[model samples]
Target: MSFLHSLGLFATLGLIYGCSTTSSLTSAQQRDAYLQQFIGQTSQSIQARLDLNSIGYQQVLAPVANDQTLTYTVIRPVTIPVPIAQNPADIDAGNIPIPVTPRAQSYDVNLQCKIIFRLENNMAKSVYYTGRTC
Candidate 1:
């Protein structure tokens, strides 16, 4: 392979590796990666950049002495699969369907994720998250 061809191949491989690694990250990992950008940003800046109303996140502020804690709470819908009672008439006779087999019914429930930013002098010192969705 020529020099240019070899360089192009390496670049393609690097992109593939980078994409695979990013795709394998869990939901919490992805959230943390996205929230990490706000570290050291001022509260005003964070407020301006993060559209709480548009994104469905509820913003709350808690004052602790001189320091403050800013929390963003969002409810995420989680679909839970539960085994439902199977009707005998619904089973096909030709297929010999087992009556003991359970059919799953999905139900959506609201799960909340709380993003907390610790602020000192109105500047975000650190950030973390808690709750089921996180």
Candidate 2:
């Protein structure tokens, strides 16, 4: 029986970072008005608080749960754009009529998570021992 030899897990994670909403009117006339509605001006990058650590097992597969409850989830990132055309029929061999396909821009961001673990075999009882994954 080995669940860290006794079974005990505790975790805490919640750190938000880098946020914005729109506040760039030349510093918005020296901040005022409720701090400019909580202020906002970003470089794009929001995510702070994700500490995952769980490692302790020694043959625990029969039924052991002093308080079975485990869950994890968080994912955000999406951007798609790619187009480069030159002399192929700028909508029919350009003629100063319609030939303007030159635009470049890029934004990349990604973060994802999905985990669910809940076990309870008659409240919990089973152990074996060997660990790695935190």
Candidate 3:
């Protein structure tokens, strides 16, 4: 009974240690980590993994003889609040109500982030990002 109890305690401690050691990355970090997989991958493989036909995908330029840059723009939706008068009341005999009460009206804006992939010898070498969304 003592041996079994010790083994069970060790197993529980191991499980707890494993769980504690595990970590979760943020959305941007996870995205960057996923994009890193394209490094050292051929253009064909990267194209196969990503949707090349998407509206955001474009071929920017080839700087050197064997170097090329592919740009991918990601559109993100952002909410912008525009203050508008939501309540307005005239003055009553007893008291005067506020002429205008400003309330937030949300409007969605499509922000963009341009990701550039540099390729050499048809293999992706590095990745860069630009624009406000990045």
* lDDT score for residue 90 of model 2: 53
For model 1, the superposed segments whose C-alpha errors exceed 4 Å read: 1-25, 51-67, 83-104
Q: Candidate 3 lDDT, tens digit per residue, 1-134?
A: 47567656655665455434332246457667777888998777775686422322233332222359656666654444433322233333445544442332344456556777898888899988897454
Ranked by TM-score from best down, the candidates are: 1, 3, 2
Output the number of the TM-score-best candidate. 1
lDDT of 1 by residue, 1-134 (tens): 77567656655665555445433447546566667788899877886686544443344443222358777766654444433333456565444555442323333456567777899988898887787454
The estimated TM-scores of all candidates read 0.55, 0.23, 0.51
Candidate 2 vs 3: which has more lDDT: 3
Count clashing pairs, candidate 1: 0
Model 2 whole-model lDDT (C-alpha atoms): 0.27
Misplaced by over 4 Å in model 3 are 1-25, 51-66, 81-104
How far is 3's C-alpha from truth in model 1 (Å)? Answer: 69
Candidate 2, residues 31-97, lDDT tens digits: the string is 2222223213111110112122211112222222234422334333332232222434554765444
Measured by lDDT, the strongest candidate is 1
Whole-model lDDT for model 1 versus the true structure?
Answer: 0.60
| All-Cα superposition RMSD per candidate | 15.4, 22.6, 18.5
How many Å off is the CA of 35 in candidate 2?
A: 38
By lDDT rank, best first, the candidates go 1, 3, 2
